[model samples]
Target: MQVKDGLTFQEVNAACGVKIVAPDLEKSIAGTTLHLANTKEQIENAETAIREEWRAIYEKMPIMCSVCKEISPRVEFIANCQKGNPCQVQ
Candidate 1:
């Protein structure tokens, strides 16, 4: 499958005629020193999206706790909880 970095790990595997495990999108192939693969376009796109998302969150006001009246610093917001940890209330 193609990674966010625009490099097709599948294609690289096909070309090398080797099968490897890549748990994360940006991991090295098993028994290989080279990283999965990446393209300029993919890297740029990834960077742009990251910057945009960061900007959006950074520009927002601090979240105040309703119970404690404590203000929390702006933090990265995740739409998907796939990474396990979501935004903490602390």
Candidate 2:
């Protein structure tokens, strides 16, 4: 098995430069109105719930490019511009 850096709500916004429906999706499911996730499990569960809840709009979900800082698909953003790469758009 491969060791992976666990994904969290903050990581998604800070690292990925994109936003999800909620910071704590599970907490939202549990009647949490604030976008706060206490634990990693909560974060993971919340993310999963977001995915499931938005399954119908999964393809339509907005994915802001961390490279170009635009609300576009990484592939499409890179393809349109003659940049370095998706992760490194120089």
Clashes of each: 0, 1
Write down the TM-score for model 2. 0.25
**Candidate 2 lDDT trough over 10 residues, lowest sum:** 27-36
Query: Which of the numbered candidates is closest to the native, going by highest lDDT?
Result: 2
Q: What is the C-alpha lDDT profile of model 1 across 16-75, one tens digit per residue?
A: 544444567363223323332389887777667666665665656476545555565545
Candidate 1 residue 38 Cα shift, in angstroms, is 1.4
Residue-by-residue lDDT tens digits, candidate 2, 1-90: 654454455333242444345444554433222334579998888777667665544444567776567686544555655664544456
The CA root-mean-square deviation of candidate 1, after full C-alpha superposition on the true structure, stands at 13.4
- Candidate 1 Cα misplacement greater than 4 A, ranges: 1-37, 61-90
The residue-level lDDT of candidate 2 at 71 comes to 87
